[model samples]
Target: MSAPSSVPLVVHVIDQLGIGGLEVVLVNLINNTPTDRYRHAIICLRGATDFKNRITVPGVSIHTLGRRPGKDFSVFRRMWSVLRKLRPAIVHSHNLPTIDMCVPAKLAGVRRLVHSEHGWDISEERGSSRKYNMMRKVLSPLVDRYVPVSKDIETWLRTGVGLPASKVLHIYNGVDTDFFHPAEGNLIPLPAPGFDLANRVVFGTVGRMQTVKDQVNLAKAFVELSRLRPDLMERARLAMIGDGDLKAECESVIAAAGLTDKTWLPGARNDVAELLRGLNVYVLPSISEGISISILEAMSCGLPVAATRVGGNPELVLEGETGLLMPSRDPVALAEALATYMDQPELMQKHGAAGRQRIEQSFSVTSMVNGYLGQYDQLLGRQHP
Candidate 1:
């Protein structure tokens, strides 16, 4: 459906359209929301990447501010001008980078303001910094509601960041179970040339290779698996999707360990569902997280998971059930977890099956879209039909 100006417009503000969990959540929310009920627009604070093409719903416009580096005060002026032209009914911003613009949104006569903390900034602690919390407190009056993607973040905003308790609402990021189901007998070939998963247990993950994501750690863990038990490592192969600043570093780690032939880094691909299907197990070795869309998507694809115990990872991965968790920055723990799953094929299958059931029961797209719709309806005082 195309955008209809007759309905309210929600301007989703973010730092960039990077290929990450938050971007996936934004695309899912916009595509799933009924276009007749609310028209949507995206405002990138700095710029947008090719990831913007994922927005399938038509008539949704995207604007960029061309922000300069290190305290570009003029970006605010540019954003203010954009807000004036859009005159959005609800300026829904994501994360701290877009929080400053809520003031500009309110000044430009926006009706309601909503902000969601998808995850912590690269530098910012989890709502614990005194200086940053002070800024959020000062601008709290301008925001109508604060939607955190996890209960952990909800606590940080209320008790740590000191936002109003009543205004803080928690929402879980969801996956399309129908779209990301278990693979049939026929699995697609890998994107990388001559890299086959035949007779090997392929443990993989899909995310931006950044410091916070700690994909490099996962690569190092794959090497450690070789050292701990070469027999198991011979049967194991690693495939990490997505690309970023740390991609080169991850490559170096795998190459140095002489596992380049056994590992596949396909950079970034749009067909994440197909890629997930080809994997026997999913891994999320992030240093931090907030209701990761990748984990949900992987689980929906019926892949057993091995994720780090940080941020919202614990909340998502049920220990001894759906997936196993390791402490962040510890490659040994991750390597051990991978070995355990590889040692027991039946256990891996059991976990993968349970993960799919969990996604259907608790993390379906309908639940996520409904949660946001309910919040929007109540905030705007519009009754839901």
Candidate 2:
């Protein structure tokens, strides 16, 4: 497709290019947006990572501020200069760390400002903290529109931060159903050797190996299930795809339970959609989420999910239909849910098919892209109408 004659450039400002849900969405937006109507750019507050390789668009430019560890005012100063130079029509910032970008974007005379809250940080200011809520309250006016990816985040912005409910726009994260869809006629390959996919029931999950994702609990749950039904050790396997600080801890738990052979920890992977198609069942054991894109990817690949009942998971998983919901940090409950899927293959297939249907209907990449484009048009009309 050729570029538009007068495209509006939208610059996405992110803290870092880490492998996470927010980063994945930003990449998708850039790659999938119509070149005819929108020109996109990315500005990373911290220096960019290999994640930059994922953007395939030819003209999309990526800039970084190269800020150090501590709080630095100079980073914002540099960001202001970049905004002035680029002169983008929209400056869109993601999550908390880069929320400060709005200050610079505003000062640099950018007319439209957007901020998206992906998920809460796990530090002392974890989602429930009053101090963080107050900070959001103060920053609300700086953002022309507050885009929260889930209903839970909208509630937090309204009640927790005291932001006007009207100012919050709920936009669920979209998955590339075309990219993540189940392959036809053996098109997608299986997992690597020793990670057998022949007769075993594979339970897979993909996310950062971080505290809120709770990979440790997922490992313990797999162990407990094995203890309860030793035969499942031969019939069921776990596939965790991603690397983080908790990898060693999750590995130690599997080793202690003699599940080193059954569990496959294949660090960061690029072929996530293909990986989702190989699984019999998918799980997201996150303590918090803002409409998990991985969950949507699994659904698009026709896999039944078993995720924690937190954040926007419930909005995606239809309990008994798309997948089961278990409480966070409860290994026994997770195991029991897994056992149900293992024991009843028909139910698993039924739910998996339902999930795939849901994605085709509601969560397709086209729908997600259109939603954002519609929002942008609406914002533009408001400005120029």
Question: RMSD in angstroms, candidate 1?
Answer: 1.7
> Can you list the residue pairs that collide in candidate 1?
none
Q: Which residue segments of model 2 deviate by more than 4 Å?
A: 1-5, 124-126, 183-194, 382-385
Off by over 4 Å in 1: 1-3, 186-189, 192-197
lDDT tens digits, residues 317-371, model 2? Answer: 9999999999988999999999999999999889989999998888877776776
State which candidate has the highest lDDT.
1
lDDT at residue 344 of model 2 (Cα atoms): 96
lDDT over C-alpha atoms for residue 380 of model 1? 89
Winning candidate number (TM-score): 1
Candidates in order have lDDT scores of 0.88, 0.85
Question: Any idea what lDDT model 1 has?
Answer: 0.88
Worst 10 residues of 2 by lDDT: 185-194
